[model samples]
Target: MSGSDVRMSAWGAVGLVAGREVSTRVRSKAFLATTGVTLLVLVAFTLVMKFLGGTGGADATVGFAGQTSVLEASLKATATSVGQEVETRAVADEARGREQVSDGDLDALLVGDGTSIQVVVKEELDAELRTALTVLAGNIELNQQIVDLGGDPGQVNQRVSQAAIDVRPIEAPRDFNGEQMVLGMVAGILIYMSLLINGQSVAQGVVEEKSSRVVELLLATIRPWQLMAGKVLGIGAVGLLQMGVIGGVGMGLAMAVGALTIEVSAAVGTVVWLVVWFLLGFVAYSLVFAALAALVSRQEDVGGVIMPPLLLVILGYVLGISILPGDPGNRLVEVLSMVPLFAPMLMPMRLAMGGVPAWQAGLAVVLVAALIPALVWLSGRVYRNAVMRSGAKVKLTDALRSA
Candidate 1:
């Protein structure tokens, strides 16, 4: 028999469609270009962050005069206590100190005569520097008072140094820190982009097939739902593969560069959650895109019909990245994390923050999982009726009624 006359199993047909989609799109220049560009951007971003600075101790250069030894020692000790490093230069000439400070050779110029201290800067001093100077001044005054009261400052300092306080936690939190926060934000972005880009691809593909009269030939052999399912599944598989590569490579690069400071287990967990949410988010949006795109016979009308799904994705992304970071425990965030429409974005963020209870996360999964079947049923109905119509645009109401 000819290719068109051959009878194929339902699974076989879907696989054929999916394989066709994967091969065609994955080999396309557009796909490779976008992936390459994203990898480059991620690498560049990591480099920029490293170049800006890491969590290493702060450093400052200071020039001092007039009884500089004791005061310099005090400043160094204070700064060192706070994980800061201060380099001291004894400038005997005040004029030379001022000129060096003006020329950017010194962060600040300190003029002290035992009991009193003065700091001169070309411009406003940073809070760290100001704090270091303030601490040095206080220590000098304390020493003077101790001497006046017939006490030894060294003995007092030695005694205070040996005193320490212990802190205990009633309930220890999960390992959520700056690196984990970054990982979470990255996951959210991946979800948003996966749904947005691949959903649009599905819509555009559906519109193209209809406009070109390709669906009629395919529908002659396979049912409409199978075609729709095949298309979404195929495109979504591509998206999943892309997301996996991006997540793996991005995390690997981050760890290699010391950008990701979280532990290995945490990183692996973050990646696992990212993949799960990506699948959930992609499936939720792709079918909706296919159904909506059926209403349009041409590529030009695709944008106007897909607004609702697009808006939902954008809203979720905004909430995930913007408000959720600063206020992960906000009542609104907690509520949204359980909502099917917003869960894909918000849930991952709450997970990253590490305070979400198991029940809440399971509930979110159940809600999102439940919505998929209903959406699939509705979109399948829409696709069956509208996939055949040609020429003018079809209304969603008419599509549902006719189906």
Candidate 2:
């Protein structure tokens, strides 16, 4: 009987093939090593960032000359408030202050000149010191003005120091912050890696099967599409499980480090979104990779033939972390997010950075979802013809040309 005539149900065939693929790959050493290493690196990076400390707490030493008691007090108080350590030393003269700063003995030196102040630094003043000095100078000038206008400088200073501005946005998205950016990046990287790694897994599997004549044996009972679908599904299942581990570990690590605090509902929703996109991206790219691999008989040739799709994945990721982080509203990002090849990577990035309308995300989903079956059908046709061919690499045009 023909393979198709004797084959079990389509779902059964695909599942049988998928099951085999999953079992084989999961047991492989490379998958285990890479997954463990990736998780370790994730944990290591988070711990490093958490314990490394931020820009605050660094010491800034300032040398002063002439009458500057008020400015020195203001500087010390400001630095303390902003979590900066400022050390002040009395210099005999301006020349001595400059010498101290030039000799690296002081970060900066302030010289009182009548009502104005001049600062000397070896290079540029440190940002914390600069801010403190500016505030101090402004307050001094304001106090002089208040005293000249027959008002109490001390009372004005108290009122000014107590005043603060609170900002409230009229229409803001739900608490999207630096933590969300990190999570979004993690999501994008996960998708990119899965697509690049598992998609290539499909390609390499195709090339290996063809090279060893395994395709002929497998094709004995199942159709070409079934084989392709099973491989993609099986490998994608492995990818999904790997992604779940990575995502869970990442979320747990982030929370453990106090870097991220997310609502249970929102966290669950994000996880769902990530899984959905990963499946879509895997299906979209895996079929194409498998079809492309079928055109090349050698493993080495897989990389050369897969350049186009690989570039698309790279471009999407590059845009995701770089441009999307800064300008989520960029015309290019908006345009690309709707395209099937780039949407899986960019749409999550956009959603994470906030300001993306529900419809735009929905539209991107609809477009990519609508395109997968068509892609599967087309890729299956290419694979059916190309898998049987051997020797020279099959041109895409030649593969698509119906016999």
- Candidate 1 residue lDDT tens string, 98-171: 99999988988887565677887989897887887788778878888999999999999899889999878886
**Global lDDT of each candidate:** 0.85, 0.85
Global CA lDDT computed for model 2: 0.85
Off by over 4 Å in 2: 1-7, 53-127, 152-176, 262-266
lDDT of 1 at 256: 88
Q: In candidate 2, how many clashes are counted?
A: 0
Task: For model 2, give the 10-residue run with minimal summed lDDT.
Answer: 49-58
